[model samples]
Target: MFNIDKNKVKHANLFAAGLALGTVGLKVLTSKDAKKVYANVVAAGIRAKDSIMQTAEKVQASSGSILADAQEINEKRRQDEALFEEEESDEK
Candidate 1:
């Protein structure tokens, strides 16, 4: 007479259930519908990236313009200061 442990039987049943669920999950993930969803997600991500890059380019261009304007203003200020100094020296 063979004695089967109840705990062993319960464990075996649980293992079988887990295996079945894993197989079904694999099948669903590999289905055509899932593939289409994945493709759409990737396409959307690419579009978002392009939009962000365009915005970044615009910002970079604007920053360069701002830096050039600042430099021009500083140069003008320096020239005015030099002229004022020359006038003061001529009077002394």
Candidate 2:
């Protein structure tokens, strides 16, 4: 037989608590009310995830348009600078 060590009293207490919780968890999980609550929580989580994804998609689409507009602005600026340099050369 294995001898009980007094030094592991804290570990023993935790183990007992874990076992008690496991038993209670089993009972709670088996109950119909707990199952309904768990199902609702899962559904809510899914809905929240879907909402977040939709917002992210909207942000992504707007950012793409903003980026395109910025590039267009930069292109126009470059072309205007080149035209101004050509005008200065003609003046000289």
Instruction: Report the lDDT tens digits of candidate 1 across residue range 2-91.
Output: 899999999999999999999999999999999999999999999999999999999999999999999999999999999999999999
The deviation in Å at residue 91 for candidate 1 is 3.3
Clashing pairs in 2: none
Candidate 1 wrongly placed segments (more than 4 Å): 1-14
Query: How far does residue 73 in candidate 2 sit from its true spot (Å)?
Result: 0.5
True lDDT of residue 31, candidate 1 = 100
State which candidate has the highest TM-score. Answer: 1
- Runs off by more than 4 Å, candidate 2: 1-21
Cα deviation of 12, candidate 2, in Å: 7.3
Report the Cα lDDT for residue 5, model 1: 100
- After aligning candidate 1 to the native by TM-score, how far in Å is the CA of 69 from where it should be? 0.8
